[model samples]
Target: MINACLLNDDDTLKLVSVAAGSTLPTNTIWLDVNQPDDEERQWLEKLLIEDVPDEDEMDDIESSSRFRVGPDGVHILSLFPQRLANDTRGVNMSFTMRKNLLLSFREDDVSIVRLLRYYIRHGKANIRSALDILLSLQDLKVDQLSDMIEDAYSTLDETADTIIEEGHVEENLEELVRQEELNGQILQALYDSRRALRFIKKTFESSLDDRQNRNIDEMLNDIESILPHTQFLANKINFQLEATMGYTNHKQNKIIKIFSVAAVVFMPPTWIASLYGMNFKFMPELDWRFGYPLSICMMILSAGATYLFFRKKGWL
Candidate 1:
């Protein structure tokens, strides 16, 4: 968890102990830390000779509303990681550059530490290799969100079309449930993307470099533009899920009602048969030769009358 990489000759980062005086090249040394504790936090501050902002300060740096400069050339670039309200898988990466040293802080476990170690050992340049790394990570999150939205878009489109073409969404119930889950994911992704962009706006210093500034701006716009659609699609998915559930319930109730009516229609016939089935003394069917035929006729007539009455009342 406390892996440190020192960028070395040949433009690479090699693994270095976090102990003091690692003798790292000032220009190539980059610190990649995950969920840094108080001790690690102090170490970075000691090395940089500047007050490293705590979590709150780190968060504040993202607002783009405040600007400050330190004695060293330490430029802070922090971007909130894209995450859902309840997501635990994604990590946030923050870059702090000062005195030709780059420091990264992340909550989610990232491979940046390994990458840095390779940079130092191999003397590779992380700045060039990792420029798109941040973008790639952001793109991954955005694409996942878009896929969920697009899936719902397709499913709802299909559900809508299925309702139009097949007259209703099939009774898989499982598919509808899956759609519900995807809706939650999509909604969460939208919020996460927005939160990340807000951080980008606050922490990004366009004056640092022209190309990076443009890249950040372009990524920000891309996130913002799709946000509205993401929200709407989430809502739409939720609505369709509710409506489909209602329709399924209605269909179930109708089936139960039919069974109830069938039972009602057979009630008279069952009653007649039960009443005459007794083997008591002087039973009519046992005594008279034609009694069986008469009883059967009476039962049939009663059943027919009951059915007719039900049909007349439109209860069939």
Candidate 2:
């Protein structure tokens, strides 16, 4: 789908749905192309007079390919955070910025885009140029990343409490693993955003006005502040993982210790019983009247002594 965002004379934003073969409005400031079909892609290519990056190209990780200057504009392929039902992941989105036009290409629906659109439609966003839209998206992305980091912090705190209390160690470990993955994605998104911002700053330093420069600086600072939290969370997650595993091992060893003590406690009684059960006709104990009671008493005494010995040695 292709949505064109146009700025009105009254400084309000209008969202237009550009169908295949339809000419984009001349006043459009931003063109958002999401999972375009073949016809839409053709229409976009025709409108922009250049080919859009495909899914594979957008997924490229090489810095040279991901960030570049071309005849079309400043091309940037950056990772954005996408929330799943149980976890978060990074989704790559391509951006091409011209002096008066900004185009975004993505295969997935990112919340940042939706939120930016909503803000624009509601007159909550102050967008003066295409570069402003790009900066606004980056700003919103940093806010979302901060929110995600806060959530990860809360989750880790709860997981730590669960681990320390020894409640559901297995479940907590699993949750920590998932949290680790989410934190990793957040870190990746932050790094990508920083790199993209730095590239834009360097490439457009001469063109950026005071406001845009300050915006970029603030975002860089925000990213710097949020980065340490991610590292702390990563370390905390690892520590919790190890702690959970140790707790599990301690519980398992306790169980094994009980079995070991029990086995040792019963060994003497078992041996005595086996000796008495031997069917030799010349066995002296069989001829004694009180032999059965004597053997039973001995078995009980032996078991008791073994148990007491264990207790005395503090191995129980």
Candidate 3:
């Protein structure tokens, strides 16, 4: 779908749905193309005078391909955080910023885009030009990353408490793994945002005014501040995982130790029984009546002695 954000006469933004055959409005400051169909893609290509990158191209990891400055405008393919039903992931979106228009193309819906659209429609966003829209989107993305980090922190704290209390070791490990994955996603998003912003700053250094530069600088600083937390969380997750595994191994070893002690305590009784079971005619126990009772007593005393020895040495 293609939605155009037009700047009205009163400085407010109006979101208009651009139909397949419709021409883009002259006052449109931002053109958001989400999972565009073939017709929509052709319309956008004709309108922007450039071909839109496909999903595969947008997923490119090379910085040179991801960020480029050409005669047409600046092109940036940046990763954004997308929340799934059961988890979170990073989605790459292509941004093309021209003199008067900011075009964003994404294969899937991004939370930041939805949020920026809502803010613009609700008069909560202060957007003067296409650049403002881009900066605002980045700013909102940073805010979202911050919120995600805070949530990760809270989750880790709870997991740590559970570990310390020794409650549900398996569940705690699973939660920690999830948190690690989430934290890694957050870190990737932050790194992508920082790199995109840095590229924007360098590309538009001569064109950007004081306010835009300041916004970019602030976002960069925020990213820098939040990076350490991700590292800390990564380290904490690793430590907790190791500790949990150790605890699990300790429990397993205890069970094995019990079985080992039981085997050792019965060894002496087994030896006595084996000796009495011999079928040799010359065996002294076969001719005597008290032989069977004496063998039983000997077996009991040997087993008892083994048990006492183990208990005395604290092996029980």
Candidate 2 local accuracy as lDDT?
0.90
What's the residue-level lDDT of 55 in candidate 3? 93
Which residue pairs does candidate 2 place in steric collision? none
Residue 39, candidate 2: how far off, in angstroms? 0.6
Q: Is candidate 1 or candidate 2 better by TM-score?
A: 2
Candidate 2: where are CA atoms >4 Å away?
164-167
Which lDDT tens digits does candidate 3 get at residues 1-316?
Answer: 9899999888989999988779778999998889999988887777665688899999999998899986668999888888886489889989899887999999998988988888887899988999898889889989999998888888878877777455679898888888889998998989999999999899889989999999999999999999999999999999888888888898889999989988887898899899888787799778899988998898889889988998999987
Tens-place lDDT digits, model 2, residues 1-316: 9889998887778998888897678788999999999988877887565697899999889999989998888999989898988778888999998878999999999999999989987889989888899999999999999999898888888887778574577789789989988988998889999999999999999989999999999999999999999989989999999988888889889999999999999999999999988898899989999999999999999999999999999877
Model 2: what TM-score? 0.95
lDDT for position 132 in model 3: 93
Candidate 1 lDDT tens digits, 50-134? 6655555554534341233456443444343233442323343555545445566666544434443454466453354333334
Ranking by lDDT: 2, 3, 1
After TM-score superposition, the amount by which residue 310's alpha carbon in candidate 2 deviates from its true location, in angstroms, is 0.8
* TM-scores of all predicted structures: 0.58, 0.95, 0.95
Lowest-scoring 10 consecutive residues by lDDT in candidate 3?
A: 159-168
Error of 3 at 99 (Å): 0.5
For all candidates in order, the CA lDDT equals 0.57, 0.90, 0.88
